[model samples]
Target: MKYLLRYQLINYLRTYKYVPPFSIFILIMVVNYTFVPNPILNSYSFTSIMLFFLMGWFTITLFHAEDEGQKIITILHSKGQSAYYGSLFIVCIAIGFCLSMVSVIYPILIGAFGEQPRVLHIIMGFLSHFSLAVLAIALSAIFTRELVKNRQNTWWGVLSILIIAVAIVTLKSVILPVKGLIWLFPPLHLALEMMSSDDSLKNIPYVFYWQFAWIVIYSMLLIGLYFFILHHKRKL
Candidate 1:
């Protein structure tokens, strides 16, 4: 597992430095800085949006890499699918945390010269953002397999729109007594709790459950794909 993590982390780090993803991340930060002044709100929304983008990039890049060369997949099969899948999931979560932290620090540093810093709140804010970002990434990974190919970004674009629509609907519907329905949409609830004034952390359990569900489903799908590829396709 450690070897698999190291291989994936190093491979992604090497490509991340050169890809348009970094430029896109910078542009996201710039937009947040220009418009979203409150660090608390900015961090949550910025991280959510950036995660959506990065998830798509990660999925496409992984597929493109696989299609272009067999070295990584060959190594993956050698190292064992369990380790490979675990490492991929861990690496994606780590990336989410790193990106959320970067976004959080930017506004905190700028606000330091004037505003009173609520360090605990800020930390919680980043945690919330990181949680949602990872959840979104997991969802994206599940939705972007060959079953739903990129097709000129059509898959991602549609998913993005659908996610926004569901969030909006869920946000409005959560006002009633149907709080149970909120668990179905992890990112929306996380973003709401982070942005709202409540600090009791009442929603953490639901977020964890939903995110865990996503991770389980994603891992299963990937594992199934690995086996299907090896057994039938003989080379994915």
Candidate 2:
């Protein structure tokens, strides 16, 4: 597993697949913090959402860094398909968390926020960034060559899922009657909304805990579905 992870990292770096999305994400942060005194939670809300899409894009790129032949070779050497997929996911998760830290911590370190951030604010910022980031990865994991078959369609499918999943909060508000249907998609918006709460350091919101639980369960389901499709539908 360690060797496989090393190989994935080397391959990902060699392909430079991480460049586009990561570069854009960094550029966005630079531009966003160019002028200081930004609102802490509001700034976090914007970056977390941006990180969601960028990380989804990064996941697709990272997962597909190895070509078909290389993946088959790696699969044969590894324990099984699960190990292979798991390593890819671990790598993506590691990358996501690293970037999440950058998004969450960079502004804080630079003191970009107009108001002094409390412990709750920092914790919520990191949590919001991480929850949405990993959800994006899980969402993108399914729409790959091993499952989606059509290369072009995989791009569109991943993009569509990310866009719709993030936008569902707005959609849910508009279509109040059918909001329950969002259980089918990742609840990324909830993470951003969680940050919007008017909670003080003395009192944390229950919704924060509830939404995190939902994100964890939802991400696990998506990952399970990805592996299930690989086991049942991938060519041997």
Candidate 3:
């Protein structure tokens, strides 16, 4: 298990497919803090959205990091589908964890906050960023090569879903009749919505409880469906 995880990590790094997403994240972080003394949660709200997109991009590249031949070889040597896919999932989540930490701590190091950031603010920033990262990964998982035969379409499919999911709040306001239908998408906006209110920040843990729980359940379903399809196709 340990070696398989390490193998996946090393393969991802050696491919350098991580470069663009990693570079873009750092570049945006610098730009995000260019105008100093930004409002804390507001600043966090914006970057968490950025992390959402980047994590989606990050997941795609990592998924394709190993070429078809190498992936087949890894699968043959591994214990089973569970170990292969499970290790990949863990590696992706681990990368998301690192990015989340950077998102929360970078602004503080640069002194970008309008006021002294409280412990609560720091916690919210990390949770928002990390939760979005996980959600993006789960959404992107179903759109990978196993199901999405066309490489180009897979990329656009993931992008379109992310855009629509994030834009649900706007869509709901514009299309009142189908608001219930629009709400079927993942509640990514809910993660950002609470952070927008000052009062919500006072009860950080309570405010995020449902949103966080929903994200967990939503992510698991998407990912489980993805694995089921991938496994079924491989068997066939």
- C-alpha local distance difference test of each model: 0.55, 0.84, 0.85
lDDT of 3 by residue, 1-236 (tens): 99999999998999989999899999999998998888988888888899899988888888888889988899899998789888888898999999999999988988988788888888778888888899999998778787899999999999999998887867666655764664467878778886786723555667477787787688888889888888889889
Between the candidate structures 1 and 2, which one is better when assessed by lDDT?
2
- Best-fitting candidate, scored by lDDT: 3
User: Quick one: ranking by TM-score, best first?
Assistant: 2, 3, 1
Which residue pairs come into collision in candidate 1? none
Model 2, runs deviating above 4 Å: 198-202, 234-236
Candidate 3: the clashing residue pairs are none
lDDT of 1 by residue, 45-122 (tens): 545556655655664454334343554565556566445555666777677678777777776666621344465556
Cα lDDT for residue 61, candidate 3: 88
Error of 3 at 179 (Å): 8.3
TM-score of 2: 0.94
Off by over 4 Å in 1: 13-18, 35-39, 68-77, 112-114, 146-154, 161-166, 169-171, 174-181, 198-236
Looking at model 2, which ten-residue stretch has the lowest summed lDDT? 195-204
Reference-based TM-score of each model: 0.66, 0.94, 0.93
